[model samples]
Target chain A: MRFLHTADWHLGRLFHARSLIEDQAYILDQFVELVRTERPDAVLIAGDVYDRAVPPPEAVALLDDVLARIILDVGVPVVLIAGNHDSAQRLEFGARLMQSQGLHVAGCTSATPACVSLHDAHGEVRLYALPYAEPAVVRDALGAELPTHEAALCAQLDAIRASHPAGVRSVVVGHAFVVGGAVSESERPLSVGGSGAVAAQAFQGFDLVALGHLHRPQTLDGRVHYAGSLLKYSLSECGHDKSVSMIELGADGSVQITPMPLRPLRDLRIVEGALAELIAAAADDARRDDYVYARLTDTGALLDPMAKLRQAYPNALAVERTVLARGGVAGDAARRLREQSTGELFASFFREVADAELDDGQRGALEQVLAGMAAAQRESA
Target chain B: MRFLHTADWHLGRLFHARSLIEDQAYILDQFVELVRTERPDAVLIAGDVYDRAVPPPEAVALLDDVLARIILDVGVPVVLIAGNHDSAQRLEFGARLMQSQGLHVAGCTSATPACVSLHDAHGEVRLYALPYAEPAVVRDALGAELPTHEAALCAQLDAIRASHPAGVRSVVVGHAFVVGGAVSESERPLSVGGSGAVAAQAFQGFDLVALGHLHRPQTLDGRVHYAGSLLKYSLSECGHDKSVSMIELGADGSVQITPMPLRPLRDLRIVEGALAELIAAAADDARRDDYVYARLTDTGALLDPMAKLRQAYPNALAVERTVLARGGVAGDAARRLREQSTGELFASFFREVADAELDDGQRGALEQVLAGMAAAQRESA
Candidate 1:
């Protein structure tokens, strides 16, 4: 049985305050085409289907459209689990009813991992789905004393092992921060201050394991795989070679895994140079339409850097003065705060208050308030 | 064919500054029991399944649980639409696949209204579901010039009539603001500054019209009925007799409508009297545990009115001195703003910024800030 494995769509993600829904929509359209061309028997989305617990309306619509195409147009069975970023109940809303349509979603952790069995010419293959769950959730569900993520996951693996006897070809799907996997800024910490890693050996018994929560595609011991996110979700993930994993489980228990690259509509690129050189490079580059994050290395101030860059690269998202001249008051932190724009000041203050960076809407509101104050002062003058 | 008709659930509503999720859960549990006992052929939730377009996670879970019980446990078919408060695409997520399981959700305005047919002992009963949509949406869907709510609804009704031929015992379920119905503060205006009301006669052809978007259960002409909300969503709805409409549609196109009252876990009560008299009344009242909105008619200065009321009514949500002494600078609005408690100041400021009242979380944060400021001032002294 052949299946496509992918995860961490993060459909409503924002990169540098710009909405990525349209970009995601474009990429998913291509994914549907790929699925249609490959004609895989099933698709496995390990987890992190949405960027937030409550996704924006457009993201929900995009998911709806893509899933419809995959299930109806391509006629492929799709299995998915909820991730730490998802609201389990929301993702699992109509899961039971959807099973008939070949769409299976497991959102909450259970004592026994939810299993779906498929029959081929040789025999039967069982697929176990384990959604992201806290150690406390596992303890409560099983009435056990599992203290860490590894313990919780090991407990679940043991249950799966018990449910299915030996010699049954099985695959396990999970969303976890497996120990030794590379981390990225886009992926949220599974637990407080980064301590929610699970041992790779906990999932050793399964023929293959498809994992999520890390935005890089890599294999551990050649059996456990992280399918990774489809697009670059953050500037830090610009270096990630995002792709989907295609796996074929032979009737004889032999397995084959391959990575099929997905070309994004707009590549996420970070360029560093002097302002003038950056503009010249952008003009010469064919990917000027790509989402650009430019870090200017100029020692002196540049006039309207973002505006100037946008003339050459229309999709420039952010422009930062990375290098500063060694000076007296310019180096002072208090002076830096005062010299920043109203948007920057408000963004910094909001980060301190909310413990999260501000979205574009918040920045827009701050800009309006500052504009109004400036107008009032000008009128008084 | 008999069915329970309900609407305006506002499942994640906030009353004053408290979440109504628990109250909604309790009421929905009873509703599930009612469905089990009544054994209706089907259930119609007209609209407003959520209080906001993007609901909190708990509300999503509650709706999922209640719907699961009604559809899976009680084994009843459910037909629902999206109201103004809901994001149509979000609610319509798995609608097509859910149809096989007897769960029908119509959340977008299409060229034609979505119709579902059920077989009863008599014969075939047709039910049309029209989800809430703005005038622009209807215009875009049908490619017509429907500039008003009435025009858009009339167009949909015309389409339904055209498709169903004639002489069929049909029921139309919709979420709309029908003209001549009493308005309540809890019910959000369908359009800006009012003007979203469709004429009652626009729905004249249907044998029965189950409507939502109004918090009061009323009939425009006996054929069109507003099932009303499940509970009192606002202080203005304290006087409303909230209930669900139970309808029996005969094969002969005859209709019998009955209002079945729902008992809430905590009833909403509005109390008005002098501060001392109100407390005395609360002491005598049996429903002191109910959510109380007190309008104190005191003419003199009252210290800590909310705190004093809370002593008598533990669930006192709000306390307001409607009539203050008409003298001195104390009567000035600016002076009153300065003299109010930190909570009050924060609430007013939040209302101005968000265009809505602050919830309990915001109020608690304000109290903490005030306490910290007071402590710092004392330390400085």
Candidate 2:
């Protein structure tokens, strides 16, 4: 049995205040072509189908168009789940009706995760789809004491196992920050601390664990895989090679996974040089349309260097001054600033102004204030 | 052939800053009961399924539940369109997939309005659904000059008529402000000027014209009808007899219209008396939970009247002081204020302050200023 595994499409995402809908569309077109060529038995999209809970109209239309092509036109079944970035209710609209047409979506967390069965020459292979759910949601749904991500996942898996027959080949599709997985800047932290990470061994018995929520495609224990995002969503992901997983399962429940590389319409890249040299190099550069992040090393002031860069690389998204951070007193200060927490930064400012370090009482008060502000920010977020 | 006609549901609407979801749900339960009891051939919701372009999650869920009960449980086909308050693209999501299950939605304006064919022992009856569209949208869709509501409706009806076979009974479902229809404060104006109103003669050829937009259940020329809103949405709508229209079509295409009254969970009421008397009356009132707008006629100062009123009428939403307006100089001033437009009020204020009638130039300048402010406010709104 063969199936395509992909996740984190993040449709309607914006990069550097510019809409990436066209870029996403370009990549999705290629994905459709790949599905048509590969002819997988089914396609499994783990989660994060949208960038935010409320996607723009064009994004909704794009998803509609793409899904129609794959399901109705190509005659392939799809199984999708909602992520933290989606409104479960909205995504699940018309879900039950669409299921007959081969579009299966699991949006909300329930007592039992949505399971789809597929039959090949070897017999039935069950796919359990667990949508991204908060610990509180899981606790309420399952009537279990799930105070953390691992507990919630374990409770779900236990429920699935209780109902499962022995010796059945199964796959678990989910969205989480698994232990030992690589992280990127674009991924929203699942929680404030270590509780968000689920242990990799939680899926010890599953044939294949397909996951999302981290934007780098990598294998863990040769049984779990991340399909990564459709495109490089952040500058931190510049060096990452984005791809989807193609899973081939044998009659004996052995899995062989292959990474199918996707070519984005515009690649993300960073260029470092003096302003003059960078402008000169633009003359011979063939990929001027690629999204570029410029690091200016020139010490002297330049007249609108960003405007000049855009003359050649029109997609230049950001610029930063790195001359002071290269090698100087300012460089040491920058490094120290990067290393210090908010409380430490405040303590250093206090020492500079009062010529004294913060006492234990003052430190405790400051920490309380900082924690309150952080909680407030998180609530608003 | 008989069908139930309803419109202006305004799901997710807020009345006086309080969510009306529960009230809406209460009334919709009765509507579903009506469908079950009447068992019409089809259910037609003319338009205004939501109060705004983006409805709250609960509203979406409510619509989903109601539609599921009507279509999936009761086995009645529903034909719904989008009103001006809806985001056409968002509402149209999964529309095609839901069609086979007998949920027909016309969210976007096209060259040809959505047509659903129903049959009876006599013959076929075509229902043309024209969702709310701006003149610009109608112009683009039909490649015609639709400069006003009348032109747009005429163009759409023309398109429907050109292809409509002769001797076939037809019904038109649309969302627009027809001429001679009463206006209410709760209804958002379709346009800035008179162009928003369409002539009733535009539906002369159709057997029945089921319409929305004006939230009053009324009939015009015994042919065009409005199925009023589910509940009173504003203080000014307190006197509205909320109901749905039931149309009975004979074999010869003659129509019999009946207004099916709905009982709301709570009614909207206005109470006029001194604060003390109003409170005294509330003790005997059986419907204290009904939403109340209090008009206080007390001449003397009262402390925290709203708080005192809430003890008896917990759902009292607004309070107004009407003592001074009942008699004397203040009464005259209040009456004048009610009769004057903003420009007239400004002109009167200028006369009182400057002891002069404003010159033509000054009047023109003031008019421009008011126009600019109005336009700005509209844009922001």
Candidate 3:
């Protein structure tokens, strides 16, 4: 059974605070074109359909239109999930009604695993959907403490294993920060309060694991694979080849993943040099037509780095200045300063801006303000 | 020839800084219900299906679903337009393809009016869609120099009138701020730098002119009318009797309007008083049950009004100290403030904040910043 395997759509999301709706639509169009040509039996969208729990109206409408075009108009069946970024309740809305139309959206609280058993002339293959769920949620669902991203996923596998019994071919889908996976720079550090690591044995029972939430198309193991996002969402994910994993499940339950290149809408390219050199290089490089994320390191300041960059490349997504560390300092103080807790640095900045040596009374006032803000945060939470 | 007239749906909108998706859905549900029960031959949504040019994805999807249900499930025909908030290009996208499906979306630059004639067993009613256009656009469309929003609108009306040389019963649809009409605070102020008003005489010859843009449901000289937005978008419009003006056109060219209430999912009430009075009043009210916007007037101080209000009404959109015009002194100051240029005010504000007089260099800096911003605005224009 051949199907287009992809996940982490992250629709309605921004690329570093800028709206990426147009870029996303562009990538999705490629996928739709691919579907139109390949004619896969079903399209498997692993998870992260949206960037946030409460997606903007544009995001929602864009997703809806894309889904309508794919599932309803294009004559293709789709199976999707909710990732960590998704509000499972909101994403899974209309799931029950939409399911009848062969569009499966399995978010949280699946009573049993949503098994889409499709049969070709050869045999039946079961596609098991295990959307990203916290270990606590799994524990509540199964009435047991499956206390890890991997553990919760393993529990789902156990259930799927039991149902398959003697000899049924099943492929598992999930969104998780797996232990053995090579994560792209953009993937959020999954550890919550220092328990980020998870056991690899969690998916021991699965024939094949389709993973998401990591935007690097690769196999964690030979069987456990990631399809990755269609495009780079952040400059942190620079130089990663974006693609969809097309998986073919054989009659005997063997699975082979063939990576299909998602047509590159843009490239995240970083360049470091003096401002003049950088400007000259940018002007020379004609690839400015593509989306570019650039960083220019210059000792002396240019009049306006943005203005200079835009002179050559009008659509530069990002441009950051990197002033070398002063004296014996190793590197850019900006990056080092950013590494510090933003609040702490902000307070220090405020002190500098005020140009007042903080005495006991001033320090006490600053501490009081910080304490008040912290208290407010706690109250809101 | 009865039709449901509604406009400024703003499908994906944020009301009082909170998402109005659920409220929009609730109101739309009523519309769907009205369509089903009343069984109007045609539904005329004058314009502004979305709040912004790029609405949230969910908003787009919800609108599509709602429109679908009305057209397909409810068995009603629809006529629509693009409002000031809309991108004409985006709204008109795929409109040409959907014309035969009983859904008429008119967001084009055609000089000749495009009419959608709905014929039932009783008779035929023609709908003339004239999406919102400024004077320059109207002038360009008609190859003339139109001077006013009224003139621009009049050009469209002339076209619509020209469409029906046979003189069949017809209704003209437009999205413009008509002069001498009662508008709520939620409606955008169109003419900040120019005369933003569309003349009443623009729709002089039409049997019924279904208007959009202005959210307050009202008739212009009893013929041209706006159905109004589905729900209140701001606390300033708290007491607004928000409704859709249901129009029933007879066999002759006469029309009747019935104001159908759009019950919000919850009431958005703003109780203005002193802190103590507000707290006392909130105690009796279901503070947690509804969206609230409050302004508390106090003699001297308000110690974190947001914190206090949030303690009782958790979802308070905003809370401000309403220092209501102290014996008309505030009004005089306000008038004087308005008279001062932003640059002058900017310098004054900075001087007050710094508690010092501005130096020549400081004044130059402030002036430069304001001038730069102004230049950028001009460039954008």
Candidate 4:
């Protein structure tokens, strides 16, 4: 059996206040082309089809168009689940109705995880879809005391395991923060702390564990895999080699996994240099249309540096002054200010502005004023 | 062939700033029960499935639940279209996939109208669904110069007629304001003027024209019918008899229409009397829980009447002073003031306040001040 695994489309996402709909549409067109060429038995989307609980209309249309092309035009079955970013109820609107069309969606957690069985020469392979659910939701659905994501996921997997026939090849698709998985700035935190992280071992029994939420395509323990996001959603993800996974399962349950790289219409990149030098280099740059985040090392103030950069790199999204970053001049100044006492800092400021040190009499007067202010504050307290 | 025809659900609608979701859910439960009992061949929801283009998540869930129950549980097919209030693209999200499950949706106007041919004992009855579309959309889709609702409807009907097989009974579902159809305040005006009203003759060829947009349940020329909204959306619709249409189509193209009344959880009503009397009467009122719009006849001031009314009628939504209404003392006073010149009105007010008419000398001083003010106003203009 052969299928493609992908996730984190993040349709309707906005990067630095600019809509990525056009970029997403372009990449999705390529994805559709890939599906047409490959003719995979089924396309498995782990989760995070949308960027928010309530996405804009265009996002809905884009998903509709893409799904129509894949399911109706290409005649391939699609198995999708809802992520933390989707409104499960909204995503599951036509789940039952669409089942006949081979579009299976598990938007909300249920007592029994949604399972689709496909057949090949080896017989049947069951694909279990577990949509992202909070611990509370899992607890309510399963009537279990799941205090953490791991507990919730464990309960869900247990349900799937109990339903599966022994000795049959099976796959589980999920959205979670797996332990030791690389993180990206664009991924929303599943929980406030480490409690959201689940050990990859929880998915050990499955033939293949397809995952989402961590926006870096990678393999965990050589069994669980993440397909990553379709595009670079944040500057921190500029280095991510975005791709989908093509899995070939043999009759004896041997698995062969291949990474299928997705080429984005405009690549995201971080360019670092002095503003003038960056602009000069951009004039000769071939990828001028790439989404750029500029990190400037220039010490002095530059007038409308972003505007200047846009002249050569029109898609420059954001700018950060390296002087203000950690280990730079502004950081040093802030650290020094944190160590200084109020009196010493005031005296130093006076010296700088007045071009002279404070006299003893002036210092004494300042001390008296400070003492009075402290006394007044204590009284109020 | 028999089917239930309904429209203008306006799910997620808020009445007097309060969500009507609970009320809607209760009524829809009864609607589903009716469908279960009747076991209609198909259910036709003409349009306006949502109150807004982007509905709240709960509304989406409610629609999902309702459709699931109707299609999956009750085993009835449903044909729904998009009205002006819906975002066509968003509403059309799983349309193609859902079609096989007998959930036909026409969210956007296309060159070909969405038609579902249902088989009955007599033969095939073609139901053509024409979702609400602006004149521009119709023009673009049909490549015709449709400048008004009538022209657009004509073009759409023409397309349906061209494609529809002759000698077959048909029903055309639409969302539009038909000429001479009684309208209530709850209905949004389709256009600025009369251009939005289509002629009843435009739907003459069809066996029955199931329509929406008009919140009142009425028949135009005994052929075009509106199912009315599920609930009274505005105060002006308090008198509307809300219901869905149950149509019986015969092989001879004969039609029998029946209004299946829907009982709301909380009825909307206008109660009139003095503030104290209304409150007193509420003590013995059997339906105090109903949504009340109180019209107080008391001329004097009352303290927080709405708050007080809620003690007896917990669902009192609004209060109005009948004294301020037309033909009351305030209205008579306003009329008298409109007739009086500024000088005459001011003199009368001086007499009422000071217990003395303006003396000639006082009048002369007032006239001079008024003249100076008028001159300044003229200069500014």
Candidate 5:
């Protein structure tokens, strides 16, 4: 069955405090055109559909528009999941209602391993939405010791496989930082907190794995791949070969993946030169530019660098005149308070932060809390 | 000409700090069903689409589901605007993109009104999305100095007529406080800083003015009306008749607005009775038994009023005992400081609030500001 695979749209992102809503729309517009052209049997968005857990209203509008086009306009079933960046509660809010519109949204880690089987010419192709899972969530869901990311993912995948036996032609969609895949510079460092891991071989059983979270669209062992974000949201993703992965899974469990091209709103070019030269270079570079970020190598101070850059690039995301001077402070008091107790820490930090005073009662309460912590540590030891 | 009038949805609203998202959906479910049954030419969500400018993700998802149903599933043209409680920049974020899907969203209070003419069997019906306009916005738009709401609205209406020459079937969907519309208890006091006077005559020329801001579905002088909020977001709106207005414009300059009853999530009730009596009375009043609030008037604080009430009303918005009193020391102090200079008032208020001292430099700066204010008052005198 022909199906398009893409994920991590991350709409409503603000790169360097400049809103990327218009830029994001530019990319989404291209995506809609692709859906209209390709006419895939079903579209799979792995995860992290929004840049933030709580996206602005504009973000909502964008996602709504795109989903409508794909599901309603094109009359294709679209299966989606909530990624680490997404608020599961929000993405899954109207799942019961959206299901009637040929759109399947899986936000709950529990309704996971959710398989959507669509009838093609040959037979049924099951699509599983395994959202980014936490170890704790897995442990709670299965009552097993899924201590690491790999274990949690393995547990969930096992559950997903149980739903469909080995004969079922299935594709697993996920948002995880898997091992063996080169971490993209733009991808936020994969969290190893309460419920995350990046163990490779988690999706060993699936015919194809559609991934997100990592902005770089690439294949791991030529099977799993990160579709990446729709647009470049940060300078860290400076050289990201940003694109969506278009994967086609056959009824016989055969797979074909293609790199879909991206259309950027503006060239996010970084130039290094002297302050004046950098500004001039940016001015020369600002040919139908949508957004720009520049760094200067001037040793001396260039007064009002941003204002100067704005004279050339109206929407310069950043203009920092590099200070090549030696970094040496006479006495950095901050280094001393690092090991202080909650009360001493507060008093010392506040002494610098605001010269704000804390009365004895408040200080005493903090001291008691520290004492309690020490006692608990000792007891545990 | 035909159009469905709906307003005061108040997504992400809190009825005394309790979320009303579910109620919003419950009410909107019926709204969509009505739209399908009615099959109106277009739908107009006047304003207050969301309760807060930064709505919670739940509200966003709820709105997405509802809008998707209206614009995509039902395949009806939808016109929307940002209300007083919403941030225009946020609401209009992806409006330009949504226009492709036959959704016209106007979120700006600019010089010219956003008039989209619909070609129907009745020749043409011009739908103007004139959102909630404050005096400053109205004055800026019309190039006129204004105080009364009526004068400001008159100026804008005159401009619309001058441009569009309101046909017999021109409709204006607005979010504003008209003079005579009955304000529900839950509806926020519309005129806060200024006494707005949106006289009935200002709505002349337009066959139907779909109004919002006042969350009570009613006709003002048999012409203007408020399409009340979907579900009760505040206790004041309890027992208020909430519904969406359906308008049908004839070939002549006459119109008929039908108040389509929106099935509220649950009948909001505020009962004052003995704690024992209310709980004993809960078995019968449970019919779409969800989201409730109560005030108990027992002689003294009964043991765990919440627990007892929960037995009958599991989803109680709030259960407050009239016997439990709140301290009013701050209120009394605020009353006394009403006549003080701004600086003095702030300083004194902060001193009491923080219970802290101001250094010499801070105090002197504050005193100098207060003295400057005193001098200004003297000069004006």
Candidate 6:
């Protein structure tokens, strides 16, 4: 059984406050062509079908068009699972009815098997889909006391394994942050602290595990793979080689994995140089049409550097100045600013101003004053 | 042939910055029950399916559930058209596929016959749907220079008429502001001044013309009718008797119209009285759960009137004070203040302050100073 694994379409995403609907549409058209040519028996989208819980109308229309073309026009079955960015109920609205037409979408996580059985030269291969859920949701759904991502996922997977028929090849699809997987800036934090990560060993029973959530493609082992996001959503993701996973499951529970590249309409690139040299280079660069994030190394400020750069590269999103940070002093200061708490920063400022360390009583008084001010502000607001 | 005609659903509407999704869902569920009990030959939804071009996820989900229940579960045919609030292409997505499932949605006005033919015990009844379109859209679709709503609609109706076979009764559905139809504050203007009002005579030929866009239920003639909206959308529409239209089209082109009241989840009401009396009456009133707009006739300034009212009427949306206007002095002044332009007000103020009217040069200098201050503030901001 052959299937294509992809996720994080992020339809209706806004990049630098500009709508990326047209760009998404263009790339998805290419995705349709890819599906047609590949002729996968089923396509698995792990999660994040929409950028927000409530997508724009054009995004909804685009999804409707793509799904219809793939399911009705190409006659291919699709299995999808909702991610954190999707409203599960909204995505699952017509899932049961859509099943008859070979569009299987799982918008909620449960202990019960939400699997689609497909046949090829192999007798049968069951693909179990688990949509993204918070630890609390998973615990409630399973009627278990699992409190962490690993425990919740393990409980759900154990139930799935118990229900699995013996000697049938199986695949597991999930939207989770797996341990040892790399992440990009655009990927939202899955949990409040460091508790969202799950272990690869928990998913060991499945022949192949298609994962999502991390925006950079990664692999825990030969059997577990991250499909990653198709588009470069942030400048920090400029280095990511976005791709989808192609899985071929054999009759004897053996699997083969291949990476399929989804070329973006306009590549995202970061360029650094003196403003003049950067502009000169951009004029002759083949990738000038790409979305550019330029970092200028000029010590003195350049007047309207962005406008000047746009003359050669019209898609320059932003220009960064390295004037104060060339020797790393400003960079260190920024790092310290991010790492320190407000109370500690204030204490340091007080010491600098007074040229003496604050006594315990003074520090306590200062903290009380700050707390009172905060309380008053909250009350008035 | 019997059919239930409804329009101006305004799903995803916001009232006083609060989402109306829950209210809309409650009403639409009742609508589903109405469809089941009535068992009309077909249901005709005239237009304004959504409040905005892009609705939230819950609104989309609600519509999906309602349509599926009516078309798939209850096994009824529904014919709908796009309103000014909808994006035609978005609403039209998957329309052809939905047609096979007894759901007909027309998203754009066209010269082509956009009709769904349904058969009853007597004969075939053609429902010609013309979605809302601007003059430009209509002209482009028809390849004509028609410049007014009446002409554009006449052309569309002519196309439908030319496609109509003899000896068969037909109904026309449209989303336009007809002349002489009552309107409410919430209904958006369909076009620039004057041109939006289409003459009622233009729709004379159809056995029944279902109209939308006017929030007040009205009839230009016995044949042309506005179903109005399902709920009281604006405070100005407090007196509107909101209802859906039930039309029975005879085989010989005779039609009977009936108004069907849709029970709202919560009624909208306006209460005007002295503060003490209104509060006293609220204790005995059973409709305190209604959304209330209160006008208190207290002569002196009242303290926290809205907060006090909420003790009895928690859903009170607005409060107006009649303190200063009790004897009509403040009311007249407020009316004049609203009616006068800035220049006129400035002139009057100058006359009062200087004991004389200003000449053109002085007025020009004042205007320039105000303009300069505005420019400086904008620049600083």
Best candidate, TM-score: 2
Off by over 4 Å in 1: A251-254, A271-285, A295-302, A319-381, B271-288, B294-312, B320-381
Cα lDDT tens digits for candidate 3, B185-278: 6675543334369788767777888989887788878878888888777665677788877787776778889998867777778778887887
lDDT, each prediction: 0.84, 0.86, 0.73, 0.87, 0.72, 0.81
Complex DockQ per candidate = 0.45, 0.58, 0.06, 0.61, 0.15, 0.30
CAPRI quality of model 2: medium
Error of 6 at A11 (Å): 2.5
Residue range B74-104, candidate 4, lDDT tens digits: 9999999998788787889999888888899
Residue pairs with clashing backbones, model 2: none
- For each model, chain A TM-score? 0.84, 0.89, 0.84, 0.86, 0.81, 0.87
How far is A265's C-alpha from truth in model 3 (Å)?
Answer: 5.7
User: Over 4 Å off in model 3, which ranges?
Assistant: A8-30, A48-173, A191-209, A221-223, A232-241, A262-381, B8-36, B41-119, B122-174, B200-207, B229-241, B251-253, B262-381
TM-score of 5: 0.62
Superposed Cα deviation of residue B37, candidate 2 (Å):
2.9
* Ranking 4 against 5 by TM-score, winner: 4
lDDT of 1 by residue, A244-356 (tens): 98988887666788999998989988899899999887767998999998888898757899999999999999886766533456657755775565556777888999999
Q: What is the lDDT of candidate 3?
A: 0.73
Tens-place lDDT per residue, model 4, A215-261, is 99998887788989888998879888899889898887777889999
Q: How do the residues B180-211 of candidate 6 rate in per-residue lDDT, one tens digit apiece?
A: 88878888766532347888888866888888
Candidate topping lDDT: 4
> Clashing residue pairs in candidate 5, if any?
A134-A195, A135-A195, B185-B236, B186-B236, B186-B237, B215-B228
- Model 5, residue B75: distance off in Å is 13
Per model, how much of the real contact set is kept?
A: 0.67, 0.49, 0.00, 0.93, 0.21, 0.35
Residue A23 in model 4: lDDT: 96
Per-residue lDDT of candidate 6, residues A1-381 (tens digit): 888888999998999887888878888888888899999999889899888776766887788889889988888888889888877766775565566678888986766959899888768888999998877778889888987878988888999988899888888888998888887878866654243798888898789898778888777877788888879999879998888878887777777888898777788899998999998897679888788988889987579998999998888898888665545777878867865645678878988999989898987777657655543432222
